[model samples]
Target: MSSPAPFSRYEFMIAWRYLRARRAEGGVSVMTWISLIGIALGVMALIATLAVRAGFRAEFVDTILGANAHTTVYMAPQRVENEFTDDVYVVPGRIQDYDAMAAKLAELPGVERTTPIVRGQVMATANDSSNVAEIFGVSLDALKAMPRIVDPQTSQGSVEDFDKGVAIGAGIQRELNLNIGDKIKLIAPEGAKTPVGTTPRVKSYEVVYVFSAGRYDIDRTRIYMPLAEAQDYFNRENVADEIEVFVTDPEKVDDWTLPLLEAAGDGAQVWNWRDASGSFLSALDMEDDVMFVILSVLVLIASMNITSGLIMLVKNKGGDIGILRTMGLTEGAVLRVFFLCGAFTGIIGTIAGVILGVLLALNVDGIMAALNALTNGGAWQPEVRGIYRLPAELRAWDIFRAIGLSLALSFIVTIFPARRAARMNPVEALRYE
Candidate 1:
């Protein structure tokens, strides 16, 4: 007959009518707006938090890569107990033919460059103050190739100049109150044992350059010296403790891992920056996941508002529902009307929140800079409160998951109220009217 009136169209029209209805006409109510706002706020929190976590991870990875090599070909530590002192020595396995090994690694695809490095820790003394600093004995050419490792304008001298002396981090200079020409002593304890109960291998170096590595730890406690000079200081002449491998993509370190290790042969072990900082990275990921779950409670709480609003709407529309049932509206159709109403609130809220969150994430850096400037009354320090500003990376999947989960929960919450409305007794519902 009349081609069973378009049920879907009828449901949508009825749902929209109810949504747009005035308070007197039983249209969308105050509860619905409250529920919508709640959902919106929750979704916004989720997206923003996820973006920030992503951003922090990305920034950390880049910083690590900048300060360290993408991959290091080194000997695994052969832990040896020092008979002279309580200190335990972790001597790295050495690469005697590092030059040839580096050349071989450089031939591999994706390898940007390879540099032999003498890496160790040394006690640095300046201004009569002493602190242990991480040291990298690297070629001046290699140091020059590293981005942000040296800033010539601010630096007192060039990388080549470091061969005659040493380049220290700005933090070191500030802490020791030493100028470019001041002398700093670097003492390596793993030196030759003399009659004087193991004399510390020590060298006095002129601070020829000052570098700002953009990382608080690096700026405070990292030093670079000419490779040959470092070798002499550590008593490892004509040998390198490791071969630092730089690659095009630090994130894809695995791709080059096996190939590089294979080229280096059996004695050398290849590891990436991630391996060196696995614990920290794992903790970051766990923190992000925990935050997501904790923040999701906000969305769940918001969905309860949808349930409350739907129940109230059904109660107010009992008479209209009675009439629809009497006119042969199926239970499923009746359920869908209220379902659509609640779903509409969730969909709108999710969309709005996602847009707001993304916009905030994209400009978070600038926002933080302005806020910091206002508070500090000056330029924003990159490392204020021991943290850089929120570095946000918004991902499509994160947004999609947030919206999907919110909408699904919203849809699920509406079912109870919709079902109750659909099952109402028409006679009793109409008797009151």
Candidate 2:
């Protein structure tokens, strides 16, 4: 009969030391090397991929957040105006008590900035360049926020001029050879077509500032114009696309969304960042999910090497196992000894993997920069999954997960061979000599 070792700190330390001693035999092998490298690759892939996802998500959120507010309120789509629903898709309308909406929302718990936006698409053209662009009209008072998004030197106009002038993106300026004083002609569907013909319409405005927001799409395709001018241009001064509000904390977005919607009652629909970016966020999530599964497969494949190595160890240690069984060692203790030996591969491999992954995450930017220098800066940019730096941001949570999964996988690989060693008969095992 075999006695079970007490599940104590001393017992675990004994297990650790015994396995570490013969580490050359138990802890180190070609297979162990393969396992460690495989694990490191997987963990590094995970950290880098997750970091990219976070960065991309952050950039996208910032793009929307800086230009707009945290939540947007809109008129429910005509299809379901009377029936209430929490779904975010809705039509445009100017809110009632416009100032009252802001004042009341500001009073709510955790609310920050409140603004409104009127959005439309317009086509821009210059002597040599022509492109479609997005236009946003905001209150003049919000112009104070320009520095939050753009370099202060890039544009001279403030949101105050939004009613009197407009701002063009830097890319638009570059493409069209435009300056602060250049005028742009906006071509949009001005009004519904009548039996007479399409309503004759073309609106033009002078560019007041050329602002750069650091995103290619925005820099190339967005223009901020005055609200009254846009309202006059679109002939829909009666409505706004959405009311923008900022919160004290971005993490409570969903929480505030529901209560704000509830407070607004059935008059409008509410949307958070996820609602504004639903498809984009979903695509990001799917990418993360795909990466995890794919990388986990690599780790699983590496585990096969651990399994084979353990089986070999059991075979090679038969005489040792037999002699130990003939002594005071019980089968249970013998099994633990072999199991620890096999498990040592996983433990050491995991430690190596964690170290390597952290180093990669922390210094990935330098590595990419070095690669770029080697290539002489020829059209190389870090993957723009979101942030400028190819990031591998790891939190304690991620570290814990990586370590847990790796160790668990290592322990699992030890079971079969360990059982075989435990079940061996001493006489038969020794007769092989």
C-alpha RMSD of each candidate structure in angstroms: 4.2, 6.4
Candidate 2 minimal-lDDT segment of 10 residues: 379-388
Per-residue accuracy of model 1 over 42-150 as CA lDDT, tens digit each: 9999999999889888877766776689888887767888888878878668888889989999999889999999988899997789887988998878988877676
TM-score of 1: 0.85
Determine the backbone clash count of candidate 2. Answer: 3
Query: Which candidate has the top score in TM-score?
Result: 1
lDDT scores of the candidates, listed in order: 0.84, 0.69
Q: Number of backbone collisions per candidate, in order?
A: 1, 3
275-300 per-residue lDDT for model 2 (tens digits): 76779878988987787777777767
**What TM-score would every model get versus the actual structure?**
0.85, 0.77
Candidate 1 accuracy as lDDT: 0.84
Off by over 4 Å in 2: 1-28, 76-97, 146-148, 151-164, 179-183, 188-208, 212-216, 236-241, 256-267, 365-390
